[model samples]
Structures are given as structure tokens and as C-alpha cells.
Target: MEGRVLITGVAGFIGFHLARRLLADGWTVLGIDNLNDYYDPGLKKDRLAQLEGHPAFQFQKIDLADRSGMEALFAGPYFDVVIHLAAQAGVRYSLQAPHSYVDSNITGLLHILEGCRAQKTAHLLFASSSSVYGANSHLPYSVHDPVDHPVSLYAATKRAGELMAHSYAHLYGIPCTGLRFFTVYGPWGRPDMAYFSFTRKILAGEAIPVFNHGKMQRDFTYIDDIIEGVTRLIPKIPNAQAAWPQDPAASAAPFRIYNIGNHTPVALTDFIGTLESCLGEKAQIEWLPMQDGDVVATYADVAELQEAVAFAPDTSLQDGLQQFVDWYRRYYG
Candidate 1:
């Protein structure tokens, strides 16, 4: 944990937070991000500015799709572990730009895997998503659940990344951990996410979209909880288990996945109500049908994560929303 750690998507919402936490914990971090216009590049740069002040943190602006750049990075001798978080992220955007998912999520991930393999890294922890449980109405989604039918191309690519990581772990004996994150929101959150956009629209006195008639639920995990889980799991890499489930979701290799979530699904209306309370404003609701590539709900079962890492996302909606609202007012006011 003290040695150099390579993090892709260093400027991303989760990535930036994770890097900050790691650096605070005395771990040296090497970060890289494409700074793509998928979101506001200004936000990414602002996040990078914080890391720039850390002596233990070094960052490079590089695209994950750049095979040559990734190769040169891997060719270096400093990285002891790789945490790959860069990807083209949005379920709805995947529908319009399927190739973007392929290029960033698929191609970008392959490069990371290759880099880990070549460098003989100690452990590789990559980001998966609760979206992989698409179309499955099963509550409290467990890592053991079958994720074969992803409703969105984004989800499918993420699931594919998990499988690919498992393959690398099996073939090369590389330690690999995949984190299935729930609805993550907090300070320095993604602008495209519902909570952030809803805050904007509500503050502007504009109507916010209420998908599924505002009946959906999400296990909204806080950023601190997410960072804790990721940090704790860094040292606990998976080993082959003799009693591994025959389920395709289970693997006998040195590959494992855990659902990092709050384990409490709050209704959309309730979530909005919390936001309204935090921001001291009422939102104009615009009811809408479910969009393509969107599931009605996402609930993560973090039992495996708790048993393995001894930690789970436990932050309440009100506390998380208050933190986000405070940051939003300061940043956007």
C-alpha cells in the first residue's frame, strides 16, 4: 500500500476522490486521465488541481484509448498496483454512442489489463457497476447474481470488463478485484448524474424529470463509503477457492467481485424530498416514462463486501445530500 499505485481516470468523480484518500494515507499515486469532453473538462481539471498539490501524487493527461501511451506507462517500473477507473460512463448515452463505450470501456480496459499483466502488478482493482444487474428485478443485487442480460450497452461493456479481468487473473495468476458500485453521489460528483442535474434544475426553478413516475429506487452510496471500501479491499486480493460456486458468476481463479453499496434503496420521491430539504427549495417535477437502457431500480447486496473487506456503504441520504448541496452552492452559487 505504500508503493506506487497507478490509477486510470484520475480526474473522474470517483477516481479523484479515491486518489485523494490514497495520497492522504501516505500512498504514492500515479494518475492518468484523458480529460475527455464527455463531461465538463473544467471539473476534471479542478479535481486535478487538488492532486497537483500533493507531493505523493503524480498525474499525466493521457487517453486510455491511446495504446502507445498506455504501453509506455506500463513499461515503467514504479507502479505496484493498478486501479482502473476510466470509462465512457452513462447508460442512456450508450444508446446513442455505442462505439464510445467500445473504445473507452472495452478498448481502454484491455490496455489496462495488458499493462497489469506486463508489469506483474501485485493487485488490480477495476470499477464495475450495479448497472450490470440490468433487467433483473432481484433486490439487493449480490455479486453471485447472473449478469448475462445487460439492458444497456454501457452495462454490457462493464460486465465484459469483469469477465476479461477474470480471464487475465486465471491465465496469468494476477490478483484482480472488481467493484460493483451502486448509485454513487457526493461532493465532486458527475454533472450528468441525476442528483447533480436535479440540484441544478431545482435551484433554477425548472422542472426536473421524474422517471418511472418517480417510483424508482437506488441504493445511493456516499463517496466516503465508496473510498473506504476501495481502500480496504486493496490489500485483500482474491485467491482460488475450493468451494467456489458453480454459478457462472463465481470463478475459481484469483478474481473476485463485490457489491459496494449502502444496502438501502431509497425511493426516487424520497430521494428528491431529501434533496429539497438540503437545498431549501422545492423541485418542479416532470413525470416521464422510463428511458431506454435504464432499469427501474438498483439495489446492491453488500454481504460479500462486508464479510471480505469488513466494510460497507452506510451513509444516510440526508447526510450525503447535505454535503453535496453545500458543495454545489459553493461551486455554482
Candidate 2:
């Protein structure tokens, strides 16, 4: 509790909430984000405003790819841990702009690894995604499962990050925790996400695109559940364990990966129904074929996450969707 933590991507949905939670728990937090216009900058600023006047919080407008800036940040303070949530995110956007993923997810992650190695940070917790379990036919995607078949550029880059982290962990003995998050949604969520956009379209009497003809399903983990799992794992950094094998997925080094997701995967149509129920308006339907780089479904096997962190996402889809709808009305109305 008496330690300073550095969180990259502080302007992002998950990062903002994580930093806020840490600050409230009496942790000194240094938050850094480029505040890119991937979505509305206004929402990002609003999130930052929530942390204003919180004595334990500090903010810096810095790009993760800026190696010098990253080095300066790590050198300035002997941080107890680094929670990296910054990345050029989005599956569809990656198809259009693949270089952005390379610059941010690949280069940016390398910079972070360098910083952690030099500073000897006790632990480094970074974000991964369920998308990495690409093209897998297996149900309830597990951390132990091979994730080499990444279907999207974004997902491939994220998997690359895990490999990069492993190399650094093996060479320098830096403790690294990689969390593969499921479909995270809640208040202050990203506008590019399906739930947020669907809500807006539905409320405005516009048609919401039901991709794959609404046949898809997702393990929609709530934002609060993600925070709970992450915070709980902060104290459980993987160290040199005799039980670990040399498998690339499971590390002999002080590194680990966990799939943090809601075990329940709701069908796309049902999820929309839940949203409609929450907003008191039926969505105008625009059934469409699946877009490029889109998958049919995603489900997480969270037994490892639950066993290791003593946490699992328990928020029901209705409850989480209702919270999002409520926030949307107040924020956009």
C-alpha cells in the first residue's frame, strides 16, 4: 500500500479506472498517456478530471513510443511496480493501419521492458487480450493453450508483446504479469467498442450493425471485474518457481499470463436485447456479414486467473449493461 506505481495509457478506459482505484487505495500513482484522438478526446479529459485534486495522482502527456520519455520516467523514481495498459487498440483499425500497431504495441512495449529492466521494478503487470487466442476452435480459451494463430494485426502485436516480455524476464529476472482481458465494458468505456456505439445508435433511432447476423458471442467482462482481478494479482507476481516448465506459454522465468474474463459468454443478439432492455428502446437492426479481422466468438478459461489471483468476474451482463446505459444517458444526454 505504501508504494508508487506507474501506469501507462492513463487516459484509456481501463487505465483511467485502474489509476483512480489505486489512488483511492492510498497509492501514489504516476499516470502517462498520449491522449490520442482515437475517439473523442473530451471523454479522456473528463476521465482525467475525475482524478483532479487527488493528492496521490500525477499526470503526464507522454507517448509510450517515446523511448527517452519512457527512460526518464523510470529513472526518476524507483517505482514499486508498473501497470502497462497503453497500446494502439482496436481490431478493425489495425486492418486499416497496421503500422500503428507496430509502433505502439511492439515498439512501445519494448521501451517499457527496457525501462523496467533498468529500474529493476519489483513487478510489471501488462495488458493482453483474448483476441490472441485467434483462430482457435477450443472453447473457454485457456492461458496454457497455444496462441500462435492470431487472426488480426492487433492481436498478433499483443502476442508479440508477450513474447517480448518473456525474453526480458528470462534475461533480467524482472517479474512480469500479462493479463489477457476479455470484452471489457462499462462506464467511461471506449467509444469504438460495440456496446458503446450500439447504445448511441439505438438511443438516436439509428440502426446498429449486427455483424455475422448476430450469431457471435462474447465473454463480456465488466470493467469493475477487470479492476478486481488486476488489483488482486498485484501482490502475486511470478518469481523463480521450480514448478514452471520451459514452455513458451508457461515460463520458467519470473513471468506469467492469465485470462481474466467473465466465464459467461452471451450471444450477440441476447446482449443487444439486454442493452435494449436497459435503455428502454429497441435497436434498429442492420444485419451484416462479419467484417474482416472479426471472429465468430471469444470465451475465456479463467480457472488459472481465479486460482492464481483468487478472483473471477461475477458481474452479470444485465447489471453491467445497465450501468453503461445509465452513464451514457447522463454523459451524452
Candidate 3:
């Protein structure tokens, strides 16, 4: 199952871990990232530094929005698999910077689709989000659920990406798999995430914003679990179904979508309490109304994922937070 794989956003949390795993598994990885300062570029650089010395690993500074650059990249090497994880990621930021979502999530994905179409890649695995299950009142979001009502521009763009990928899969016969990741958190995670920021504020004795009056819940999947689900799926390329059941998650073409999540929802208050225990410090909670583009809760129905890959995220919040806290202390110290 090891071969040349092109991983977009290799410096990001999940991408960095996936690259390290694939490289250790004897896969030649050419990872590309824009190294944008959406968060701290220093963190991205440090993540890249960990993989730079690997013999089978190569790094390139290429933005997904760059058409010619992506064209040139695909023109050079015949990638057996393309893992598209690069995107302008943030739920609230999309409110202020709507255009960035269209550029990275929409246009950026188009360039990827075109490249995959031309290269005829074996499997094209791209990152989607649980946010795509916006405006749906369903408890455990399923891939078969209708994702027509997106609460934010970010969610809309993600839904658009799924549709675009589906179109390409149907038109060009490309094997496409869309992964809807739940609240992913761990060491070397995005600073924009609430858990990461909350840790910083709690340590500084600052009031951490508790949105939705701490009533919200999230299916916080650990980074290692996310990587494991993705790794198992890389070789499970979808085959064209002979008879389509008109399901949104599957198609007659070589296309499918799966929810990669822990399937366990933890309340926001409970999550904060767990973090406080991990940090050995009480967080000064600043209760606030729910911000725009924020969902009340997110729970994933990972039955299909388990059925497909025989794996589901089962890491407890306590253990995962402990691992993250240990890493944070070592890295920040």
C-alpha cells in the first residue's frame, strides 16, 4: 500500500502526523503547503522541521490556489495517491474573510480536481468537515444526511467542495473519498481551536470564553485517531457501485464520503473540566452567547467508517488531553 503520495498541507496538525506515518511506512511523500499565517507560521515551520530530514520526504512551498504551480507539480510526478488537506480553515474567520474560503476551499479544490483528472490518480482523498452537517438537528450526523443548509460561509464552501469532488468523480471516473472530520484536537494542533486557546488562557489565569453558556457539545476526535482512520482508508479506494441507492454518501461512480469522528459527544462544560484537571488549574470562564457560525453540538455516526475500515476513534477525552498537555508543557517551556 506504500507508494508516492502527494499530501497537501503537510505542516498542519493532521497532515504532519500523516506524513510522518506514511514516511515511516515506506511511502515517498511530497508534501506542499502555503505556510500561510492564518495562525502562527512558526508552529507550521516546526512541524515541517520534524519531517524535513526524512529520506523519503520532500517539502514544497506551493499554494493550492496557484493553478500553474499545481499544474507543474502534477506534470512532474505520477502520484499514486493525493491527500488534499490544505484549506483556509476556520468557522468564524470566514465571516470576516469570506473570499478566502472560496479561494482555498473552492478554487483550490478545483485545481486539485483538475490535476487528479489529468494524472488519473489511484485515489483522491480530500478533507471535509463536520460543519458541513450544518443546520441539521440530527444527533449523530451521517454522511447520508442532507447538507443543503450551511450555517456559515465556511460550511457552505465545504459542502461545495464535496459536490465538486463528486462531479469530478462522476465525470472523470476518479476514485474520490471525502472525509468529514469532527472536532479534531491534540498536540501540534491548530491554535485557532478553542481547546488550544483555552489552554493558553487558563495557564495565564485569563478568562476563557465559554460560548453557548457552556451548553454546547462536540465529538472531539483525537489527532492520532484521525490519522489512523485516514491511514486505513488510503488503500481502501472506492469502486463504482453497479446499482446506486440514491444515497448522498455513495454513488455509482467511484466516489464516497465517511464521517471520521469519535462518535462520542462531550458537553462543553465537561470538556473544560477535563482540561482544567489536565492542566491542574481552574479556568476563569467567561460565559458568552453563542457566536455566529457556531453549532450547538456535533456528534458523528461513525458506523459506516467502522464498517468500511473496521476502525473508529475510541480515545477518551481524559487520555487525549493529558497527552496534549504533556506536549504543550514540553514545547512551550
Q: Which candidate's TM-score is highest?
A: 3
Deviating ranges (above 4 Å) for candidate 1 = none
lDDT of 3 by residue, 1-333 (tens): 889999999999899999999998899999999999999999999999999999999999999899999999999989999999999999999999999999999999999999999999999999999999999998889988889999999999999999999999999999999999999999999999999999999999999999889989999999999999999999999999999999887799999999999999999999999999999999999899999999999999998999999999999999999999999999999
Can you give the lDDT of residue 266 in candidate 1?
A: 94
Q: What does the lDDT come to for candidate 3?
A: 0.95
Whichever of 1 and 3 has more lDDT, that candidate is 3
Off by over 4 Å in 3: none
Model 2 ranges with Cα > 4 A deviation? 246-249
Q: For each candidate, what TM-score against the reference?
A: 0.98, 0.98, 0.99
Better of 1 and 3 by TM-score: 3
The TM-score obtained by model 1 is 0.98
lDDT of 1 at 272: 94
- Supply every candidate's count of residue pairs whose N, Cα or C atoms clash at under 3 angstroms: 0, 0, 0
RMSD of each: 1.0, 1.0, 0.6
lDDT of each: 0.91, 0.92, 0.95
Q: Which ten contiguous residues of candidate 1 have the minimum total lDDT?
A: 241-250
In candidate 2, position 53 carries an lDDT of 74
